[model samples]
Structure formats: C-alpha cells, structure tokens
Target: MSREIVAGVDGSPESLAAADWAAREARRRRLPLRLVHAWRWEPLEIPLEQDRPSQERTADDVLRKAESTIAERHPGLPLTAEVLQDTPVAALLSTEERAEMLVIGSRGYGAVAGFLLGSYGQQIIAGAHRPVVAVRSRDGAGGGDPEGGVVVVGQLGSADDGAPALGFAFETAAARGASVRAVRAWSLPPLYAYSPTSSALARADEAGGLVPYEEQALREALAPWRERFPEVRVTEHVEIGSAGQVLLGSSGDARLLVVGRRARRGVIGSRIGSVAHAALHLAPCPVVVVPHE
Candidate 1:
C-alpha cells in the first residue's frame, strides 16, 4: 500500500498548521509524512555573476531550516526534503504524483497577501492526480479540537456534480467520528419573475412549492449517506447567493470544507470544482477536494 502524506512547507503559520494537520492525519492513517520545501533563485537582470554564491547559500539555508523544523517536531516520520528551482506549483504537483494525498495550507505568503490561498495551492489541486487536502489555519476551536467534529460539504443543488462527493465526505467524516453538513446555495435569477417561462414557474411556486422541491432534492440526495452513518450529525442549509461565496462563508468555523473537483473538461487534467476552486482560494479553514471517485 502507498503510505505517505505530502505537504508543502514554506515557514508560514498556515503552512505550520498544515504540517501539524498532516502529521496527525498520517499518524491516524498509519502512513509516513513527506515534508517538502521548494525554493528558486532568480538571477538579477544586471548580471548573472552578481550575488550568485550568496544566492545559492541563502537557498541552501532556507531548505536546511525547513528540514530541521520537521525533523524536530516529527522525528522519524520517514520524511524527505527537496529544494527545487522550479515554480512552487510545479514542484508540489511533481511531489504529489506518488503521494496518496497532497495536503497544503489553504493560504500562503502571496504577493497580494491576506487570507486568500496562494496560486501554488490552487494550481496543485487543479493538476493533482491524487486527492488533495487544502488545510486551513487553527481558527477558533476547529483544529486539533477533538476526534468527533464536523466535516461540511458544500452542495450546489446539481446532483450530477455534487451528489457523488457525499460518499467520500461521509466516509472521511465518519472515520473521525464527525458529523456532516450538506449545504446548498440557491438563488432566484433576476429574470425569474419576468421570463417567458415565468407563468409556469410562478404556478409551481404556489405555497412556496419550488423552495420545498429544491430542499427535498438536496435532502434525498444526502439520504443514503445519512442512513449509513446514523450516528453522524447531519444538517442542511439552503442559502441565497453565489455557491462559492456561500460555501466559503459558512465554513469559517468548520473542521474542514469538503468539496468536489470542478474544472472545465478537455483542457485541464484535474480541474478544481467551481465551488471548491473558489473556496480553496478564500477558505478560512482547510478544504478537502473529493474527486469523482
């Protein structure tokens, strides 16, 4: 069996949280943890010789520090380190090729800064062949809080895309003695009341019929999984707004924001799902992307 949890470390607080989370996950799964830190040296335009030796030494120092930190915290973790000159995204994707799952800090030290996830995390998830877990900071009582917490999956009301991921989410949540939150993002388009189909839609909306129909669809979709994990706490929310925004907003205090991969087919190898993609970019906590499998 393949046994390793891979994560990128760059000495950031969020990445440190990711390291801790990955360590705990590996311990729970009885797998090894591979901690990788990638760095690049960009030569100045003035001349190739200027600051060359110093630059190389600095890169070496950074890599050594990263390796030592992991070794100290997780001794004998079967760890390995890589100092690559390739872009961060490329290095991470390459490292994840053989990993069972790639775990990354949701947010990183980016050019723009703030809570937004760095481009490296997004790109790695978009191209990873294995499962990717985007970890968030230990905000509030979410991290290392307990074994039984909650794993929330954002639902888009479209079973074709959202339904399949519930199985994986439930399995993960159940493994940790956790509950599942199946949420949906709903909205009435501006043309809802003025469209050519408006009359038919209105007729169906009598007694808030349309709302219930949508709710029932989500509930039924989640029923099978709920039945299997009867002990798991289950809750549903139908919020009005952008699917990505709603999911990202609701998961501020969640243990993990579980989502499905959504990307335009044909052009991309592994595309992050619409909601998952957006949430990974702004989630206040970790985000797990459950592929079609």
Candidate 2:
C-alpha cells in the first residue's frame, strides 16, 4: 500500500471539512494527499437527457473545487484528484487499498438519531482495509487540550484485544508530540464469587488501593508500547464502568480516539463492534477504528 492519505470529497460541507483535515494530516506526515469523488447515475435529473455526461461533469467539477480548496489552504502539498464511477462506499474502499489511512466525512452527531452514520458511512468504515477516520464538519481540527496533548484509546478484552489500538494511539502521539491516555474499564466481580483469599493469588495486590488486578493488567498491556515510544508521556486510567462511556469520558479535548474491531463482519448490518458503535455516534473528536484479527 502507498504511504499516502486518501479523503472522500463530493462538495458536501462535511466532505470538504474532511478534506481539510486530511490535507493538514498530510502536511503533518509529509505524505501526499489524494481527493476522490465518486459518481453514479440518478433517475430523475434534467429530463434524463444530460444524464451520464452531465453527471460526469458534475463529478469533475466537485473534484476540482475540492482540489482548489485543499491547495489554497495547504500550498505546495502534493495532491492528486480522481473521479470514480462506482458507488461511494465501493469507490472509497477500492481507493483505500492503496492508502495508508482513509479519512471520510460524518454528520457529527452525539445524541441524535441515524442520520449521522447512514448505511454508506457505516459500510465504508466497515469495509476499509486500513485505518478509517470519521471527521465531522465542525471543528475539523478534532480537538486540543491545554495542559497536554492527549490521544485516548480503549483497552478491552484479552491482552491482544487492544494491541492494535494502543499501537495506533502511541504512533499518533509520537507523531504529534502528544501524550497517550490508555483507559481500561472494569466492573465489580459478581457478589456470589469469593474474593481472592491471599496476596499470593494469581493477581496479587501491588499497592495503592486501585483495583490491584486491573491496575496490573493495565500496566502489563502498556509495557511494550511504553518501551517502544519512550519519549511519549503516558497516562494509565483504570475505571469501573462501560467501555464506551469510559473512553468518551477520558477523550475530552483529545486530538483522536482509537478503538479496535474484529476482522469478521456480522451476518447482517455493520460489524464495527460495540465500542466503535458508541464512538462513531458520540465522540466529540475524530475517531479512528482500527481493524485487527
């Protein structure tokens, strides 16, 4: 795959907003930027006479407009523009095969209904081969923190479950000179179960009354990444709550939030997983859903 960034643009305010973010990210990574617009025929437009050619021209025009906007804002950035004849999701998925990361637009809804993540957006995120970022129209900068730059990632399941997401968060933080906030959520053991009787148990108490077992697990999870990115400041947040709620709560003013998804799709509907489901709908900042086996 090419080490470049790809963004979908169709002249919508949301698409342009995503393009702006993609351009800025391109500048950050010193990688080239590609803007793609996909067009398909519509049944009822201009008497059906100016059908195919008119649609093609419109697609080209949209591409040009988005290209010009990116150029004006990010001068001297290597840019490429293309118009695809496939549907939005198919075209973007095809383009993403050659890109390091794919950036797309979202309606930016938190508590609102189904409009923000329509079938198309969900399909694109689910079908992508690489990391996908859904950036909302407003506040294209994602977010910023005054005390320190933060990138939060949710750690769930087995030791390997969150490996991909934590690696992504650390890589991003290192690139931006930001710190990473690694959060792991837990719940109280079922009351029927007996607590460990001795300190020699599997998860012995470390110190500091903070859920010793969970705290140890969190530290073990972050150990390798911490060694890999020694310069990146790290924060380990262990809490008792839902994973989605914990991630959203810890991600305030963060530049990005990272979540993981299994590679398999469900029998029906989007298979981006639970944490990602909550994140795409409610995250105040951009969310990157990384797929891992």
Model 1: residues with Cα > 4 Å off, grouped in runs: 1-3, 40-45, 48-64, 75-78, 106-114, 129-131, 136-146, 189-208, 227-231, 265-274, 290-293
Q: What C-alpha lDDT values do all the predictions have?
A: 0.69, 0.81
Measured with C-alpha atoms, the lDDT of residue 1 in candidate 2 is 44
Candidate 1: clashing pairs of residues: 136-286, 261-273, 262-272, 262-273
Weakest ten-residue segment in model 1 by summed lDDT: 106-115
lDDT of 2 by residue, 1-293 (tens): 45889999978888888898888777777889999999877667455455678778888999999999889878999999999888999999887657878999888654333127667888888887688988887746332222337899888866688898889888888877889999999876555544576443334445544377777778888999999999999989999999888988888767788998887767785587788998888887778999887
- Candidate with the greatest lDDT versus the true structure: 2
Q: Estimate, for each residue in 214-240, the C-alpha lDDT of model 1 and write its tens digit.
A: 677688788888888787888888777
Best by the TM-score measure: 2
